[model samples]
Target: MTAAKRQFHADVFITLKRLVNDPEGIEIRNGLHNLGYDDVSEVRAGKYMQLQVEAANEDEALASVNEMCERLLCNTVIEEFRVSILEPQAT
Candidate 1:
């Protein structure tokens, strides 16, 4: 008998490279400064995604999430991504 696939939760974080200028982040910082929060020097905005994956094992789930990030989740040229895989949950 074959083992059943397990469920994995993946968290993806996408952000722009330091060399890249973030217009939105700058606007946010400007707004903060206007509100009397001048201590805020810089702000960098990013994206966070939570995904539930079905796989036979943790490694498989990780690979799948990585591929998803490389393919569609993130812009590899100007942006970078990080993935965190949680332990399998009870069925």
Candidate 2:
């Protein structure tokens, strides 16, 4: 008998650093305030991506996704990234 390869799903969020200026976020916040949503305090714009990865285990999958984020998905100089692994639901 052979072991089957495990598949993992990841959700990645890429956002600008706190010190970095986000014009789009500011614009959206202003628009919301103008629309009478005065309670809206801060708005931050970011990128969300879902990836299906094939790996032997959760650690391997996470490592691969981290590398992808560092190399291509996010700008490390001015952006920060977060990864969330989604557990497979029972069928």
Candidate 3:
């Protein structure tokens, strides 16, 4: 019998580069300080995305996820991304 293709889940985190100015993050930080959280120093806004892909192996799944991120998920010029493979949990 042929082996069934495996399904992979990818967790993508897209964050703005340090050199890029983040107005949203600054606003949040200011709010926090006003709320009495003076210890808070910096805040960075980002996006989190989950993707499901069908592939033969982990490598293939990762490659597909990376392509998706580069093409649609993240702006490579001003943003950076990280990918994590989530293992299936037991029932």
- Candidate 1 has an lDDT of 0.94
lDDT, candidate 3, 19-58, per-residue tens: 9999999999999999999999999999999987777777
Instruction: Please tell me which predicted candidate would have the highest TM-score against the true structure.
Output: 1
Over 1-91, each residue of candidate 2 has an lDDT whose tens digit, in order, gives: 6555577889999999999999999999999999999999999999999998877777878889999999999999999999987764434
- Which regions of candidate 3 deviate over 4 angstroms? 1-3, 89-91
**Sliding window of 10 residues with minimal summed lDDT for model 1:** 82-91
Ranking by lDDT: 1, 2, 3
Per-residue accuracy of model 1 over 1-91 as CA lDDT, tens digit each? 8778988999999999989999999999999999999999999999999999998888889899999999999999999999999998766
Listed in order, each prediction's TM-score against the native is 0.91, 0.90, 0.89
Candidate 2 residues lying further than 4 Å off, grouped into runs, are 1-3, 89-91
By TM-score, the better pick of 1 and 2 is: 1
Error of 1 at 12 (Å): 0.1
